[model samples]
Target: MNEAISLEAVSKVYGKGRGAVAALREVSVGLPEGGFTAIMGPSGSGKSTFLHCAAGLDRPSSGRVRLGGTDLAELSETKLTELRRERAGFVFQAFNLVSSLTVAQNITLPLRLAGKRADARRLAAIVERVGLTERTGHRPGQLSGGQQQRVAIARALIADPEVIFADEPTGALDTMTAREVLGLLRETVDALGQTIVMVTHDPVAASYADAVLFLADGRVVDTMTGPTAAGVADRMIRLGAWAK
Candidate 1:
């Protein structure tokens, strides 16, 4: 399968000289074009740093990050920003919706930001796909946590992006709501062939993915396929993630 994102010996450093801290250490991984991959690690394991670099939100201090065929290191800030806006989508734990905007507005915000118009048919389809068609006129403040996340997911899907990067997407939800959200994510992969790379700490959340990549001390330590919640929890235990 083709890779949606590829990292080759990528490393990120903060500060300089004696004060320099390495957040990522020659990390290399590739996300398949139509796969759902979860990233897990102990606290301070560079999960956020890895996500930032891979998503082109932050540049690697050394090595390369390729999003599809484009090398991120080769793009200027303006070009990179444009590329990210056009090709990638993001979801976060907080939902990150504009409080003043209605659900429809929030979902189409990315198109507006890119100076593109939203197709009425596409908008309706995406809204319906996320099971938020009835709530399109409601503002974020009026929606429940799960409903708000559905809005976020709809927003991510609006662009038909090559990859969606989610950071603790279900972190704030209750177990049942989280399952619903996870099911939606799974549907996107299986039904829409959407590629997703999610950074999560929850074992159950990780189990929703096609595969799980484990990180430790700024490096890839292991990987598990056909993961189960129980299995992931055990692996995290062995990695000493729970102790911290």
Candidate 2:
């Protein structure tokens, strides 16, 4: 398993001196290429912060984060932005599509910004894969919540990024919709060999990943493999996350 993401003794602190607040502390983890991983933690447990640092969306104050063998900490802001565009993809609970843009436009916007053209054939194939082929011309406001999320997923895949980072990808959906979206994410990893690192609090969501990392108080506290919703719940329970 070649490493796609590597973090070494990473620490992130907000503010300075006596007013400083430690957000992450000496955290480290390795994500195998072409693998799917889920991160779980209670609120303010550093799950989102860790994901941001690992994906180069945020920098750790004192540590190293590498994506696809390139040191993210060493890159300049422009270079870091380029690296993210070239090698990393991002998804969030909220569908951040432009209300006026059609599904096709939303999907190809990144390509247009990168000054690269989106191949018509490739765009059509991806649209079909996301079950949005028939809705390509519809604006985001005209789509269902589930369909909006599908568009987001398609947009993330359009760049053929080395890794996709999702923060609460299922947080805003209903149970059925969440399950459907989770299935799609898992399908992409299993069928497309997409490397995904998802930050989720739900055990059901964690079950979709090949592995799960549990964080607490800004540190990785445990990990589990062959993940099942039950197994993930037990780990969270042990961490007092599932209890009052």
Candidate 3:
């Protein structure tokens, strides 16, 4: 399979000299096209840093991040911004929605911001797929946490991006709500060919992924494939990843 996102020996450091701290060290990962992947690691194990650098939210201190065929290191700030906006989609624990906009408007916000016309059928279909068709007329504040996240997923999907980065999407959700959201995310990959890289600590959540990349310190220490929740937990434990 072709790579959608590839991090080549990437490294990120904060501060300088004696005061400097290494966030990621010689980290390399490949997210396959149309693949749903989970990245699991301890709190300070460079999971966020890796995602930020890989997503072009922050530049790596060294090495390269390739999204599709373009090398992010070669782009100017403006160009990088355009590339991120046009080619990437993000979903995080935070809603990051505009409170003033209706759900339909929020879902099509990216297209609107880029001065492109939103396709009515596509928008309507995606909203339905995410189970948000009934909530389209309402604003985020009028919805529950689960409903809000469904909108966020719909918004990310409306763009039809090459890669979707979801950073702990279920972190702020309750158990039942988390399962619903996660199931929808997995459904997107299976039914719509959506490529996703999700950062999560929960073994049950990671089980939904096609492949799980286990990170220790700043490096990929192991990988589990076609995993069940118990299988993933066993592998993570053996890799010395924190269980609780």
Model number with the top lDDT: 1
How many angstroms is residue 137 displaced in model 2 relative to the true structure, after the best TM-score fit? 0.3
Model 2 lDDT tens row, 1-244: 8999999999999998999888899998899988999999877889999999999988999989998879987899999988888788888999899998899999988888889999999999889888999999999999989999999999999999999999999999999999999999988998899999999999999999999998888899889998999989988888864423
Candidate 3 residues 1-244, lDDT tens each?
9999999999999999999988889988889999999998776778888889989999999999999899999999999888877788889998789999999999999988888889999998998998887899999999999999999999888879988999999999999999999999999999989999999989999999999888877788778889789988887777663424
| Candidate 1 wrongly placed segments (more than 4 Å) | 241-244
Q: Choose the strongest candidate by TM-score.
A: 1
- Output the better candidate (2/3) by TM-score: 2
Per candidate, the number of residue pairs that clash is: 0, 0, 0
lDDT of 3 at 179: 98
Task: Order the numbered candidates by lDDT, best leading.
Answer: 1, 2, 3
State TM-scores per candidate: 0.98, 0.97, 0.96
RMSD of 2: 1.4
Task: Evaluate model 2: give its lDDT.
Answer: 0.91
